[model samples]
Target: RMSTISSAINLPTIYALSTPPGQRSAIALIRVTGTQSKYIYHKLTGKEKNPVPRKAMYRNLYMPGSNILLDSTIVLYFKAPHSFTGEDIIELHCHGGRAVTSAILNSIQALNDMENGIDIRYAGPGEFSRRSFQNDKFDLTELESINQLIDSETELQRRCALSSFNGENKVMFQNWRQTLIENMAPLTAIVDFGEEIEIEGMESILNNIKRDVLKLKKEVQSFIERIEKSSILQNGIRISLLGKPNAGKSSLINSLTNNDVSIVSSIPGTTRDSIDAPIDINGYKVIITDTAGLREQSDDIIENLGIERAIEKSKRSDICLFVLEADSSMKIDESLNKLLLSKELQDKKVILVVNKEDLIINKDELRTMIHNLNNEMKNQYPILPISCLNQCGISDLIDLLTKEFKELSDTSDGADPIIMSQRVKDILINDVIFGLNSFIDCLDSDIDIVLATENLNLAIEGIGKITGQVVGIEEVLDVVFANFCVGK
Candidate 1:
């Protein structure tokens, strides 16, 4: 209903350039939408008749309250409710000069200000899309779609955005929700309209509800899990390669990218800082980093900063690559190895990569030793033997990283959607979901249960964000717009 009203607003005087700024195009288009759109149009057009929607007609654009020429242009008008923003919108073909565009915009601004407020301010980033949601032409899921599309920089994120934008998440979630609601009827009726409940009937209803909830819960959990696990890795899985100096760390990076991005040398501490490159892994973006080889050292300021950055990067990375030379049968240096094995960085996202297979004299011994080490550690540590010079086993390494990152989304684990936004997720889990938990108690109670209704009402406030159900109605203009950029 609110959507219908906002749609009725006629943006009557909305304007935005259809193309991004600074493009070297032969012509530029400035578009306008709203009820006053025709007013803006006629003021400049100086003619009563206009070109039909989708058709370009040549005409001279005029200044308001004056016959002065602004530009000789082609104009097209789209009637209400059928165009973007669901309002009467117009497009003008004008010369692609900054001065000309600004002149026309300034003239329109002056005319619009005479009435009350400027007809349009620079359409705030994503304002057009937001207005579409306000007008009810699109839903919350679709709103996120525009965001996802804008944010997508790789195959995995693209698929995620595309899938959800195409209504994969919406259809799946809504269907499951509807099924839960349908199954809830039998159990809920006991409280809603029950006389003296019979034991067998009550048991059957409880059993049915339990079964349905468990089934739906499993689906929801897995969906959320998969998205969560894959979200970080999907955007770009951070893989940190850690090792003592000259464990072929630089060689591995160069081999993967097939470029000499990092200097490869047999010298100890060849790389003091972490070097990173983005490569597609299993069709997902994996940001692989070659960190400074771990060593006991303290001297140069620049080198110290590099080591510090490497440590910080490793700490935040989704996965760590523990690189060990296959030729080195000597035990790992105690202190340095202990730091790597500590609980702080251990338990997950760490792997034992045995490098320099071509230089290994006894591959059999290294394999047995690595196997024994794994047994003693009792971790899910994978020992992969490879020669960085030969580029062997790198694909397997990437494949393993991709699998682990994808599993992080663990939708089967039953987390509510992998709410990415800290603000949104916190509101849902800490605020809204907690409220839902309390409201569940009301479902089985016999009191007026106004609290339950209230909780349900409050849940609408949060869920409304997901579905955009209450965007501009119950809410004031409290929506602080975001400037979230892609590949951050």
Candidate 2:
């Protein structure tokens, strides 16, 4: 299938707007690649000869067979065998106006209509990256790294993706494959022949293979654990706001997100459901959920349901913001007190947020109240005072959240390597774990040597899937490349 895809790259030239499609930017990038790139470059530029490879040339593009000027652009050409796709490539750096981009694209497509012109078509999503993979410019893992780097929303995501893109993960996987192949050699020899081959240290070889497999399994499991821990960086951290009615939870949500995503109202029980607003805090993605405030009892069915959802969301959140109105005379409500003491929220990072601080003149009373609550709760939860009306202390709140987020999402250590691709991680978790465990089981029991060899083969193939070392990888390639944007 790979060879088939590689051979199909010979004829039609593919082009697309490599940059985002919009007029917001000052410039746009158009990429063309395949066998007819040189011809297309010369024809569009009205030059008898193609420009020097890797050199930029200023040219006025024109519709094929017509003198209609398309745009004044900076063009570049890359000769085959050394280009991104291992084929002739052309780049048109044109104005970002929609009309200009559309006109140039239409003119490029017109090349297919010429009497002796080569085939030209728009590039599909990830087609450029796929071509790079097919041409040996990159492997599946590196291609995945490129996609992750493009989609990354946090610093950790970028660092991990860049590390993998630089071949750190590839080198690690290659070493594992080599180890598997080395161990499999002795086992394969015993399995191939029905009769026991007279070999020295047969028992010793089997024992040594078990030790190696055990060590490899431990390493793989450790990596899996690290992947699981760091996955929160990819998926935003969840935060739930819990407090009494009209305690300014909604206001805090709006201030945190800098958008009025939740309705703010003075009347009690205004929020009847959980409202989610995803925000980026210091490059850390966070999902802040504004839940219906907790009360001792609610007659309204909808309000009751909202309160229930608040509890459920709080239980699942990584952080819980327990808002309290600083000016209000009422103490913590019965339901809120019950929730604070509940085992479900005990393990979560609960911060006592004193809102409406702008209404208070003296800080001593508020401090006494916080001190009392801390003594009663015995949790010593971090307390932050903020006034959403004035946006006071919001930055400090954000900073605190960012600090906690760093600790929660930290995957850095000198020993463990990071795998950013979910595809690769899934392959490791589902396929590699199964093979390794099965092989170990076979070795531990009085199972057949042939069966143990087959299990080892399964493990090898699973690792091969990560770096594209196995066969029948067309489906894997499709999934990996699907994450990319058009012309990437």
Candidate 3:
């Protein structure tokens, strides 16, 4: 059954457009991978002569079983064992037009039907990447890195993904695995051959193993933490504007995004739901949300629901901008105080934004209000006085946000590679850590040699799973590759 499933997964031939679809552009790439890639290329191009491997050739694509030209394209061929997916691969770089690209793809399909019958088919999501994985071209980490690179929208994200794709994490995991196996060798030898072996410095060896295992565990923990923080950098940081009615939350969002993403009005409760806008602030992606204004009393059911949603948004946000009108009352309400001080929101970063600062008659009064609010909070939360209407102090606010984001999310200098996928995290925690713990228990407890060796083997296998040295369960592979796009 397993062999059948594996065989089904490793289809004979597959093709996909390696580029995004759209109107006419400079170029579009279509990739094919299989043992018969060269044959298919010859048939499609109607060229009797074989093209040199790894060299680009200009050719005219023709309709299958006809001399009608589809499009003039650049073609390249890669032979088996030296190409992506470890198969004979063909890449067609054609003029990027809806009609031309589609016609070329259809011609390939037609040729497949006429010659190979159902052997060639359109590639599924991540199928090319999965094939590369199955063929030993790259490991799971590299495959995941490729996916991350494709999905990356920020500079830091791209750098991290590129580093992983270059096998930084794989090399780290491999070294750890090698160290583990070497550590386990003495224990295995002692188990296989009794005291006759007369192993020297057994105590020292065991102590070294223990220290290494502890160090590895700490490294894994650090990787987990870094990945968690870097995720905020990858997915834009969420900052929600939360305040009372007409506190200039919408105005601030509009100013920040430089567009009327949210409706601004003098009347309260104009924003009945959270409106999110993603803006690039100093190259960092910041998702600023304009949430509904909080109020104690509302006759409208929708307004009450909006207030509840606003509270929820504030609780979940990475940073809460508590906007208060400087000219009006600067008191934080009981409900707002309760929400801010709640355990759920205690760890969240708070920035007290005193809006409409331009309208303030007395600067000392504004400072006094901010001081009182800080005293009530019992913490020195950074306060910024800004006029959302007049665009005053906007640059300072942006600089503050950028600094916070960098402190929280920057991982460029870190040596440890980040683990992006939750599946990888689960394997590391449940399998790798569990195995290490089991092995360590055997060493510390002076358990039977056989049991210790068995636990050590389990630990080695767990490390193998991380680097795809040992193919994981089918479900795990599915979860890992499911995030990839069809062409990847």
Candidate 4:
């Protein structure tokens, strides 16, 4: 049903540059797809015969009306049902130059204006991918995976996206859907022939449905947990450095990024705002934020405002590095300790960092102080003694962070595909889970078979939304494809 609607609305030939738009590269690829794709190819190449399907041929392109030579290009043709969009397709590979690529695109537009009976237009963002979905080339999850693959920044993200694009999620969804249908079949049979079914067989079928639902519920819960954990990998892990003035917060940021991302000064409250520096940590993207130092008694309005911002950043961060001076006579600030114990930071992971370790006269005394502080707070947060000035213990800090990140991102034990989109989760929870619960309740209460089957159908439709099998909502496709590039 959706395929027919898509085909009806998308009847014209569409074209766009499939490669990044720039002049630095050696070549650029332009893709065309539609029923009239062969016509457009012939007009551009001035060849009566189309190039062999799936074969590249060298040809000279020309302007449609004046027959003016444009450029010598390599062209490939694909017949319907075999191309990316499952339509007649043509690809032109031309030299990557500001003038050459622009001239080729402009010529195609000019031909569209002069031609009759066939329409050709530039593709919109994700339009190529949308067409592929419409033609049943790939499901919605696979489409999202392709977009993720393109936008991937880290090795783990790339591998996960590639796994989804290769039909990992599709296979999982199919198995779930089949199990659901098998369970629904017995309920449907009971509804159609209520009295004709044997009592023992009915009891067996009901038991089977209950067992399958329990198993599926467990699997769905596990998938949700995996998604939550893998989210740190999908969106880079955020670590915020927070402490009182002159605690080496800025210095630590500079050391991690190896650049002057944050200004380091001995003056209190030198940093008035949060500065974010993104760095690659062992194939994972980690964003470290250097925030304004916390202070209890600040007469300066700007300093107080900076402290407020620092607290807010700490609340949102995945990990908070609470820095302290190893040589200072004062203990941790009472106000800062209270803030760390507040409800806003309940979920945040805290790590104690004692800076300027080289300045400490006694190592055993420093360790004793840290241990006592941990006991006083009633939390055994990992403490690392470091000297930012001497670059001591920086490697140890990195190793600790890497270990934490690996624990959060590990997915070796599960066979279920990762769910990347929050929209998918919303649908599963609000629609699929709700419908499943309704059906299960109906069965447990010995409700009408018709009502139970109706709820079961609703559950299946909800699951179908994930794969674009039953497209009740057009907005779902719009949202999914909106993130893709124009040529995808």
The best candidate by lDDT is 2
Each candidate structure's TM-score, on Cα atoms with residue i matched to residue i, is 0.69, 0.86, 0.81, 0.82
Better of 2 and 3 by TM-score: 2
lDDT of each structure? 0.58, 0.76, 0.73, 0.74
Ordered list by lDDT, greatest first: 2, 4, 3, 1
Model 1 Cα lDDT, one tens digit per residue, 1-488? 54345435534355666655556667878877666777777778877765577677788887777888888888888887777666777778888777667667766666676357445544555556555656767665665655666655555556656666676666654565456456545545554665464545665565555465456546645544555565664346677776656676667766665532222221233232335445655545566654433333222212233445445657777777767777655344444345455565664577778788777667688677667556655445677887888777877776666567656545234332232333344445554455455455564564224554455445445545555545354342234235422110
Q: What is the lDDT of candidate 1?
A: 0.58
lDDT by residue for model 2 over 1-488, one digit each (tens)?
33235574545789999898866678999999988887788778888875898888889998777788988999988888789888888999998978889888888887774356567899988998878777778877888888888877666567778888988878888888889899999888877655456767778999999899889989989888878777887776888776656777777877976732322221233233335534567666677654433332222322244456556778778998878778646455555566666788877888878898888877887678767666666456788888999998888888788678766766334332264677878889877888889898988898578888888888898888888877887776788778689989
Steric clash count of candidate 2: 0
Q: Which residue segments of model 2 deviate by more than 4 Å?
A: 1-11, 22-25, 113-117, 258-275, 290-307, 328-330, 390-392, 411-419
Clashes of each: 21, 0, 0, 0
Task: Point out where model 3 deviates above 4 Å.
Answer: 1-11, 21-27, 52-56, 79-82, 95-99, 113-119, 194-201, 259-274, 277-280, 283-285, 288-312, 328-342, 361-377, 410-419, 471-479
Which candidate number has the best TM-score?
2
Candidate 4: Cα lDDT at 444: 85
| Candidate 2 to native Cα RMSD, angstroms | 5.2
RMSD of each: 7.3, 5.2, 5.9, 5.5
Write down the TM-score for model 2.
0.86
